[model samples]
Target: MQIVEDDIRVDELCTRREYARWLVRLNSLLERNPKHRIVPTISLSGSLAVAFDDISVDDPDFVYIQALAEAGIIPSKLSSTSLFSVTPEDGSFYFNPDRYLSRKDMINWRAQLEYAILPGTKEQMSRIRADYMDVKDISSDTSPEFFADMLTGEKSIIRKVFGQSRRFQPNKPSTKAQAAVTLTSGRMAEAVQHELLRMEAESSSRQAAAEEIKSELLVRGDIKNFWNEKLLVERNRGVEVQKLYIATLQDLDKEKNLQAQNLTENMKEKAAMDCQRHLILTLREEIEETSERLASERATYVAEQCNIQELRKAALMDQEGILDSKSILEAEVEALRILRTWVEDEAKKSQARAKVLEEVGRRWKWDNQA
Candidate 1:
């Protein structure tokens, strides 16, 4: 008997590791015996390890065994005796391998045996042993094949074998098409539901993406419109400045024509009386006025031009500012869209998780009822 340490905590008695060790040992023993090949598999019931730890006993014990005779591990005839019987003295069952072996001349024939240990104190082991031995003879060969033909059988080992075989084994996945069909039928509803959920999630993601694109387009259009409006205002101001400049040049031209007419008329009236002096004086006055007017008009035009230049520069700055704003807005919109999408995705994931949890709960309930 190899002792394996217990690791998993259940009750105070046994651990998962100890249980695993015993299972391994039992499986190995069953595999060695051809006679016991009728036995399908072995399984342990209840908290065997926990029970063992609670026991203060020092002796060995047999707890329970479920023998599967259909697997050809245990002999069909001897399967009934497979049900465990406890011994009170040592809390162990005694096996007389020689009685079962017909050929006494055979040497070193080992009986393949496997047992589980149950918990009990040293003092309790003796009492349990006595109780077990008093009930029935577990070692008795109840098979009729080796007995007289006229003898009536008192007990059927086959029935006991079947009864003890009512243990659980993990079901293996089916490879055959028929078994696969059966599994598909059983899980069809869940598979359909899962696929539907996946499609719905994909659709929602697409819808969110479309909405984000729309939002970006709207913001870009607004920024573009604002920038264009500012450009239009600056263009209109430039037109006004050009019109004012043209009007000033037309007024200066009219003043020059009026002064030229006045000088020619004065020179004709002073003929032969030294009219040259009068004509020169008139021309000088006219020239002085024209110069003064030209100077004033130039000053006004320069001031207007400076103002227009400043306005143009301001418009340019405004255009740049609008562009900057547009860029910032674009970035912000993109970020908002991304964040919104992420939030929606997270929400969907959470919903999916909840749905899965609900489905698991329903399945668990159905299995329990079954």
Candidate 2:
């Protein structure tokens, strides 16, 4: 089952028909080598069938095949087959398995492989023509140049599987030896990649476990600190509670002593108030008696004043009568004074008559003696 030639150069080129034949040979070589069990991402048989269907049903080919079949230039069996049964499931029947593979076919194979390996929902062949595809080196979308740039990009399936290359000539044909070497190289690269991914996954798991263990240890320390703080709080609370209990007992005893003192003072005050009440009642009664006595004495004094006023009026009338009698006595005294003055004149006349009679007796004695 020797598949690749020792003299197959990397730059050797062939036609699309020739490349298909080589691809079939590569798949056969991979199958016979049981030691390398790498599964191809794309089925070589399916890709060939699709190519055969395209060539058969295309406008020119269909017209040519119809013309040939109707004129009896070609077999009629192809007309009935009509590229209809070339489904993904039954494609191997149309294309000869030993046909040579073209660069276009290689692009299809690599793109399918990328679709299988990479992460995306859109199919790889469709993405090759999508506007977002960065294969700027490609000359035309309809030509084989487009797939050449797609397969030769930095992260392309061919670059990943077969290592980096300066160019991917999609129009160039592929030899059987070249196809075998590319397939073998791709399988080995995938194996090595799988191994590296497994090792990296294990390393990441170990790092995550270490981080988790560190986090648990930190949590344990925090728990210990929380309990220590809780113990201190409980101790302080106990001390405060004991102090509060003692203070409450002292306050209760003080309250009891104050209540007993208040009761004694209340009884003493009640007795004093009762005695004062009795004294006030006695004073009120005495005041009533004194008021009655004063009223009676005032009436008696009023009667005595009336009697004194009558005596004063009688004395004034008697003094007036005595004054009239004294005036009559003074008039009688004046009449007696006039009668005494007349008697004094008669005494003087009697004295003179005596003197005359004494003179006559002296003369008669003289006449008798002669």
Candidate 3:
């Protein structure tokens, strides 16, 4: 990960955002699709070679490597999670989604993660295979009409979710909207918080100590980095929880592609249109639970936005106060300058008076002596 480390300072503490990004990269490597292509790395002159849109030396594996000539960090400053903190007490590794950040001894972290995830992935695949094994049998023995009926039954539930999402998606401030984002956008608390901090720090009072610190942190890209990490952590948590289902979904996709070959043109078009709603996983607990969660999260988001507006208003008031203080300090400085000038004028007059008396005394002594 020293791709960016050559000129970056090692002693620089990782900002929360940087830490959060680190967590995602590390988790993405260990917990994501096993076959997801890792970004390629190239070395030249004992440093990472320049490249465009590829690779990060900040990755956990390479960040602490002693052989690289990049800026580094105190490895212990980071908090620990599953792979970093694993103990083979009973000989099985624990998977706590705790800190997800750091620990000192990281030489074998990848080994620890492999040890933890290997058995879980195998078990999950076995269960998924067992569940899907009957699909071919069910299709082969069924008549055409019976098979069509089965597809219709399952497709209707999917249609309901797809239709509902379509209905609500337009109501959102939808000049532009991403398909995967509509549902996840319901969790808007973090976005609201980001707006609040951004507004407050955009123009902070220089004389106000707290505001100065805020501005400095904002300038250094520290403030937003912290919040971004928190959001990434939440996203990664959801991703980790759903990790096992990824393999199942991959198998399901293959079956779907095979089944699609038999469909007519119109039916295929309809199927393609509904695929956008795949993110709306409203099964198991039913649609109502998803709706309720969305509503609750949306309400929380609105409340936070209101709070941000209030905070910005308060910040404006503080800025006004700082301006008033600036005017008062300026007036006091003018008065001090005037007083100093008057004192200098009086000292010059006293010096002139002393010189006159000295001249008079010297003349009187010369006349008495004559």
RMSD of each: 57.2, 38.8, 48.5
Model 3 Cα lDDT, one tens digit per residue, 1-370: 1213345444443332343233334333333334321222321235533221122345444432211212111112121223124334444322221222221111112222222233355444334432122344332221222222223332322122233232222112211112112111211224435555766776454347787788999999998999899989989998986885897899899988877775666587777766745545445356888789989999999999999999999999999999999999989989888988888888887788778877888888888899
- Give per-residue CA lDDT, model 1, range 82-142, as digits (tens): 4324223444332221122211001001112211123543334334322111224223332
**Which structure among the candidates has the greatest TM-score?**
2
Residue 126, model 1, lDDT: 35
Clashes of each: 27, 12, 8
Model 2 agreement with the true structure over 173-232: per-residue lDDT tens digits:
565545544544444446445656977999999999999987886877975787889999
Off by over 4 Å in 1: 1-284
If ranked by TM-score, best first, what sequence of candidates would result? 2, 1, 3
In terms of lDDT, model 3 sits at: 0.42
lDDT of 3 at 333: 88
lDDT of each: 0.43, 0.52, 0.42
* Worst 10 contiguous positions by lDDT, candidate 1: 102-111
lDDT of 1 at 104: 9
List TM-scores for all candidates, in order: 0.24, 0.29, 0.22
Report the Cα lDDT for candidate 2: 0.52
Question: Of 2 and 3, which scores higher on lDDT?
Answer: 2
